[model samples]
Target: MAGAQTYESTRARVEQYFDRTATRTWERLTSDAPVSGIRATVRAGRDRMRDLMLAQLPQDLTGARILDAGCGTGALAVALAARGADVVAIDISPALIDIARRRQPEGLPGRIEFRAGDMLTPELGHFDHAMAMDSMIYYGAADIAGCLGRLAPRLAESFVFTLAPRTPLLMAMWRVGQVFPRADRSPTMVPHSVKGIARAMRRAEVQGNLRQIERVNSGFYISSALEFRP
Candidate 1:
């Protein structure tokens, strides 16, 4: 379980990063305020990506059991529940989990079970669908395969998640980002190429399609969504 331990360490670091900037991150995600700067625009783009991912879900979620893997701040969980899908949301960050629980909406057609834990290991029950948004960026190729391998069996339908693109242009940009590091950046964030992700999915015995998401002011495509059937 060396890989698991590595992932745990990665999660711990990510937790620390989010905990320190939870307030600002939450505002960036939930607010529509007119903010200036490239960071603000990137945040808005991420929000739009979330909307696009949600739209990819099944039109009818009534009575569906959904796994909101790495459910940061519970935005997607709330949206899913609002659409009548019972959601089991898990995250490694305690502060973000607390924020999600505290800010949970009042009424919804479906219920949400918020838990603070690693997505790599959760005592999850059967789910109709599972989604991991931008959370998978913290994992490398092998870890991604490991996660998908475990999660595939628990899912009856499909799995949807995002991954950082490994294109040459983006790789170069990622390298450039290293020179001017931001306080909010997570050290564990590793970009995977499209081929690498597809290989991981294959190793996990999942078949899926991928589409490159448009990058805003960023040099490369932000991330691509992988929609797979187990």
Candidate 2:
């Protein structure tokens, strides 16, 4: 992994790329009439992440208004709704949101609302809880605090965000890549180290608990559960 890219320009470029690719990816993930094999990959990834998030959340999801930020394919949103939370799942890509809306399970008692929009924006209202799974990787360092800060007021009392940890080894590799700017300007995929994440939370005036858990092979995702003042 290269060093983390936190430049504003780089962040904008990454978002643009995602908007372009989201359509194809969404279509491939939601092909359910015949159940395409690619759908399995989407299902597996969503299942792994949803299960982990649900296990970590302490609140009863029943009837709670939960916001699923960067809700790709809406797996977490759908799952949360099925478990009783009233969900508002938002994503930047319309293609992905369409797929997620189409995949809404039949006769689900819990309500789910899908929106196509950016998480950094203020339109998304505060809710009982919010979760950004694997979505913070797109932000530049300058935007991390702003992104989370905007959501703080919307949180009724708590929120959760998952991020890829920026490690020392990864930072070194990223620095080496910076020397060869033309080779592959792609910044490191790692977002923030554990310490850096803590700082970000403090900067955002968010408080509660932070934990790092290894989800797959050797990689870890940091989960920050925030308790906000009413």
Candidate 3:
């Protein structure tokens, strides 16, 4: 377990991170064409990530309420909304949300909402599905457990989240970061080991299946998509 800052403070820092990283992430996500062979290779990789997530979604999205937790550029939120889900995309960064709002279709058939809020807060309404993408790495065992506990009941159907592998080196870095989260010339993510994540999820009483997806590129990521019924 680790001590984390209050939701208000964490949300502020998360917003700052998005303000710094959104431009590049947006350009990467929205590019019409890849500039190099590596870029082209990565495109398929990114799409595969999205596809794997969507495959886990229910067949009919109409009237399906969804929460996109830490939705970076709102790509997933827009896609789900387009598919007829009532989408509420929440992010700590209003700047990124602004970009996402601008990028969203003005006359889409379905409604999509954008919210700037903290993930640990209960103010955000309930949903049939809730997703926290790569942002799941930001919390430690305690905070992660607490956040998931908060989300469990709010998620009427399921919750899905992505996590980076927690190698020993990564965990060491996270422990070091407790002293200085925004340290030095670079900011680092706090990755969780698969075992640690599973333990925490179980403690939170959330059940899910875990799978490893190898993208077109050599890079691999882990996804844990939990299905819950209340």
Give me the candidate number with maximum lDDT: 1
- TM-scores, one per candidate: 0.83, 0.72, 0.75
All models: lDDT? 0.75, 0.62, 0.64
Q: Per-residue CA lDDT of candidate 2, range 1-230, in tens?
A: 11224434555554555567446655654454344455565455555656767776654678788888888778788778877888889877676887788888887768898998766556666588788776676454435555655666677765566654465655675567556554224334554655675576676565545556544322232323222232
Question: Lowest-lDDT window of 10 residues in candidate 2?
Answer: 217-226
* Superposed Cα deviation of residue 69, candidate 3 (Å): 0.6
Model 3 has an lDDT value of 0.64
- Stretches off by above 4 angstroms in model 1 are 21-23, 176-185, 201-221
Quality of model 2 by C-alpha lDDT? 0.62
The residue pairs in collision within model 3 are: none
Which model, 2 or 3, shows the larger lDDT? 3
Runs in model 2 with CA error above 4 Å?
1-11, 26-46, 58-60, 168-188, 203-209, 213-215, 218-230
| Total clashing pairs for each candidate | 0, 3, 0
Ranking by TM-score: 1, 3, 2
Worst 10 residues of 1 by lDDT: 212-221
- True lDDT of residue 196, candidate 1: 79
Of 1 and 2, the candidate ranking higher by TM-score = 1
